[model samples]
Target: MIPGMGAVATTFVAGVEAVRKGFATPIGSLTQMGTVRLGRRTESRAPKVNEFVPLAGLNDLVFTGWDIFEDDMYAAASNAGVLERALLDQVKPFLSSIQPRKAVFDHNYVKRLDGPNVKKGKNKMDLVEQVRQDIRDFKKSSGASRLVMIWCGSTETFIEQGPAHQSVKAFEKALTQNDESIAPSMIYAYASLSEGVPFGNGAPNLTVDVPAMHELSRRNEAPICGKDFKTGQTLIKTILAPGFKARLLGLSGWYSTNILGNRDGEVLDDPGSFKTKEESKLGVLEHILQPRLYPELYGNIFHKVRINYYPPRG
Candidate 1:
């Protein structure tokens, strides 16, 4: 299951269906296309990763997600325009069969976006309970023994780990009191972890990066990961920065700018949401370059990231 069935989520669902139907190849999917070397190099024992490790096949996957917008997966995929119409049409029936559930959303957290399809609750804890119920219903209906939740959601307003995030007890109390510190992403994470479902965060929100979440994950034996999906600019930086550092290259400044018109672009147009993304992007270089280790080469460097929302590009 997923939260925020937007461009990323729809593309994923449609792409998987397309691949399963043999319309296209899973080119960038490591699990589908990658190989792992075993034993000695001379053994020539390289096998596909999926063969080496147990994993679900494309046909075994099922799709469901929550969206503040009321569009079904087909409509959402078309609106995204990430995939060609011809490809989407081939998978239209399959995509159309999937519809998003009402999402847990708040205008305060995602300032630039709002939609009619949203969950209503008396407090944050009530929202959590509602989400938990959604999980149970999906599990029963889908007949899937194990489940995972990937947060393909929008970037929320910048927030820090606070007193409410220090422990599960504190978080529960804060949720009951409708604390402003608890963002929508956190609510989903809390619900998923509580249900013992693995949760993967695909946006730069302080979702599972807290002590309370850590404790919950351990107690429930549910896996949780991420603050961002390094698919674009950050992916490039992670690749190139390490090479630059290995070669002992020096950098004085690095500036990155992007102009996008998708829903993500519009959402990031809000400064609060942009700040969260900025923090995730800016940390990449400092981490790979090891500024503390190579003070002379990296310490004084300036880094700037700017994102401009251009609807015309869409």
Candidate 2:
């Protein structure tokens, strides 16, 4: 299940449905279109990833998720305007039937956005329990063998690991006491890991990056990964930066700026929220360039990232 049924999540669901109905192809999805090469290069044993691996087909896959807004998937996708009306209309029956459950959200974490469709609890622990119940109910109703949670939620305010996030015991105490460091995203991660559900973080929130969450993942044998999905400019940076580093090219400065008018852009307008995204985006160059190894060429290089919110431009 997805945590945030916003533009990205709804667009993905609608795209999958369109592909299932033969209206369109899964052009950009690696799982659907990518091929895996088996054995030596001379061997012509390559096959499509779906055919090579024991993966579920598009027709068998199910979608359900939570969102801060009360809109169903169809309405959400329409409001997002990411996909054309004609395309979304073709999958209206399927998309309209998938309604989002109330999400666990907090204004402190994402200051620029708020909605009434949110979970209310006495404490963070209570919120986690409610999410756990939602997972159980969805599983029983869907009759799926296994489940995975992908955090397609908004970026939360920048937060550092505190004493509360050091261990599972400390985390539980903090959750019960409603600690400020525990964001709503963390609550969902904790709940999913506790129930043995593998979780993925699409946004750059410190949702599954802390020691307590890692410990829980290990204990439960639930695989977990991600702080960012790394697309757009960052993807290019990952592809090109290594070339410059390998050639030992000197780099003095790098400036990256963006103008996103989506819901993500609105949420990132707040400085606290921007800091979270900045941390994730800024780390790429440092790690890729490895200034320690190439001090003369990469050390002391300047890097900047600015994300401007342009509502009409998304």
Candidate 3:
């Protein structure tokens, strides 16, 4: 299951269908293509990761997601333009079979994006219940014995952990009170954890990274991981920064900029959403370089991240 069936979600579903049909290989997927070495190096006991462990095959996967727009996966993929028309046509029937459900959304959280397909509820807790119901309904209808939720939602407005996020009790109370700090992503995380479903956050929102969520995850035995997907620029930074630090290189400044016209780019055009992404991106270097330990090499370095919404580029 997923929230926000936008370009990322559509492309993923389409790609998986394409791979399952033998149209392409699952390149770069560790579970599918990676190898693991076991025992002693002299043993030469390297095996495919999937063979080394019992993992779900591509055919075993099912798809469903929530989106503010009501488009089915085929239409959504067509709009995204990430995949070629010819490729999408090959998986058209499979893609067309998957349709997005109404999403729990808030215009205040994502200032630049809104759609007709949104859940209506009296309060935040009500929304959580609605999401829980959606999870249950999907599980029964899809006949998925086991389930996992990955949040592919847009970046919400920047927010810090607050009183409402301190405990499950406080969070539940805040939900009833319709607390502004409780963004839509948090509602989904709370609902998924409550249902004992693993939740993976793919956006830089304060979704699962909270005390209340941590407590719920421990109590329910549901794993949760978050804040963003290190794809593109951040992926490169993670790879390069560690090498630079290992070699004891000094950094002066790093200015990163991106321009795109996808829904992600448009959503990030809003400063509130951009601030959330900025925080996630800026922390990468500090975490790897450890400015406190290497003050001389990293403390005074300047880092700037800029994202421009260029409609023509899409």
Candidate 4:
């Protein structure tokens, strides 16, 4: 479930539906109909991931989510304004069917948004209860026994580690106390863990990666992984950086820039959010370069990422 099913989510869902309907191919994602090499040139064999593994069937999988706006997925996709008209028209019915539940939102998390479809409560815990109700209702309504929530939502403010996020017990107490450290994404994470559902943070919110959420996941016998699901440009970086390390490429400078008109680009327009993404970008070097190990080669490498949220040219 994409909590905020905008462009990426709609594209993913529409692409999947189109593939299911024999109208298009799953072009980008590796999970759907992706092939893997077997052994060697001698073997000359490769197999689709689905064929190789006992993966859950796509027909059996269900998608449901939350959004701050009341717009259905089709409308959200249209608003995101990413995909072409022909493609959206082709998948309108499928997109329309996947209406989002009212969002578990915090305006403090995303300052630019103000929508009518938001859920409200006296405190963060009440917000959690509403989201839990949403999960329960979605499961019941959709008749889906298995559920996974991926937070494809907007980035919240920068939250530093604090006592409120130290442990599950402490975090729960903070939720009741309305601690400022309890950001919106953290509230959603708490809800998912409480419901015995696995959660993934698609945005760079560090939602499930927090010590509190990680502890909650372990305690609940659920799995959680995030910081982000790298998309677009970052995917390229992951590949090239690894190859650079493998080939011993002396990297003097690496500058990454992107210009696009989309919700993603718009969200990152904020300095705080740009900082969120910029940090995620910086993390690549810290992990890939191993500053402790390669202080000589990577210490001086000037890497900068710039993304301008330009409106669509058309």
Candidate 5:
């Protein structure tokens, strides 16, 4: 399922709908058109991934989600700033029909975001129960045998690991005590895991990646992965930085910035949220270079990532 169906999700939905209607091809996705290689390279034995696996067809995917805002999927997708107007227009009707259910949110975690279509509860634990109800309702209404929860929401502020993140039991206790470490993403994760749905995290926030959440995922037998995306400029940095490492060159300091005029940029202006993203982006360097093993060549370097929000004309 696609949560926080803003730009990425909406564009994806519109494109998928367009493809299903035979309007265009599914670009930027390997599974749709990419070929897999087997045996010797000279043998020319590359087969499509679909032919090899018992994967469900694209038509089988039924999208659903909970958004803090009440915008229909089309409107949300339009505002997400990832797709062209003409493309969104093509799938407007399909997008309009998919409205978001009330999301389970707490402003404390995501200070920059606020939504009217959200569940209300006196305590954090109560909010968990409400999310569980939403899951049950969505499943019965859609009649989908399997479900997945993907977090595409704005990044929450940085939260350090605490006792609540130790295990599911301690985590629930933290929920009962309204633990500060327990961010809103954890609530969605807890609910999704409780219902046996696989949760995909697209944000840099410490949602399903934490120990408590990871434990819950294994207990529930669901898969999860993410820490921001290696897309756009970040994806480029990943490639360039690796080349520097291959030649034994040190990156004393590397500066990068994105001039984006969108809700995402506005939300990231807050340092707390930006720091969460910054740290996630920072790991790519040392992880790629193994700086710890080579302290003399690549240690104590500064890596700065910046984003400036701007307003643009229609």
Candidate 6:
């Protein structure tokens, strides 16, 4: 299951369907085309990753997610403009049949986005329960034997770990009281972990990173990890920064800017939302370069990231 069925999520689901039907290829997904080596290079034991591991095949996947908009996947994909209409048309019935459930959303966390299809609860804990019920219902209705929840939600306003996030006990209390520090992403993460489902965060939000969430993950035996999906600019940074470090190249400044026009871009137009994404992007160079150890090359290097929302570009 997923949250925020916008461009990224819709494109992914539609592409998977297209690939499953042999109309297109899973170009960017490693699970489809990647290989793994079982032993030494001399052994020549490499096999397709899916074959090497007992991973689920494309036919087993049942796509479902929560979206702020009521549009079905086909309409959402069309609005996204990321895939060709002809291709989407081929899978229209499949896409159209998958409608999004109501989302757990708050205008405060993401100031620029809102929709009528949102869950309403008396408090935070109630919201969590609703989401958990959604998971259960989806499993029963879809006949999914196993499940994972991948958060492709918007970037929430930047928030530091506070008293409410210190422990599972405190988090529960805060949830009962509807603490202001608890964001929607946290609620979703909590709900997924509560259901013993592995949680994967694809956006730059403090969802599964807090101590409380960690405790829940451990207690529930749910695998959880992520602050962001390493795509777009970050993917390039990881590839090139290692090369620069290996060559010991001196860097004065690095400036990165993105022009995105999707729903994500609109949410990030808010300063509060952008702050969360900014920190996620800014940390890449520092961690990659290890400026404290290599002071001469990376220390005091000016790094800036800017995201401009230009809807026409989408």
lDDT of 4 by residue, 182-276 (tens): 88888888999999889888878757666888888988887887777787678778888888887766678888987857677777787877787
Shift of residue 298 alpha carbon in model 5, Å: 2.2
> Which candidate number would show the highest TM-score if scored against the true structure?
1
- The TM-score, computed over Cα atoms with residue i paired to residue i, of candidate 1 is 0.98
lDDT, candidate 6, 48-94, per-residue tens: 88888899999999989998889999999899999988999999999
**Candidate 6 residue spans exceeding 4 A from truth:** none
- In order, the Cα lDDT scores of the candidates are 0.93, 0.92, 0.92, 0.80, 0.81, 0.91
Off by over 4 Å in 1: 312-314
Write one digit per residue (lDDT tens) for candidate 1, span 134-170.
9999999998878999999999999998999999999
TM-score of each: 0.98, 0.98, 0.98, 0.93, 0.94, 0.98
Between candidates 2 and 5, name the one with more favorable TM-score.
Answer: 2
* Model 3: per-residue Cα lDDT over 102-154, one tens digit each: 99999999999989999999999999999999999999998998999999989
Report clashes for each candidate as comma-separated counts: 0, 0, 0, 0, 1, 0
- The local distance difference test score of model 1 is 0.93
Which whole-number lDDT from 0 to 100 does residue 212 have in model 5?
A: 82
The 10-residue segment of model 6 with minimum total lDDT is 305-314
Model 3 has an lDDT value of 0.92
Better of 1 and 5 by TM-score: 1
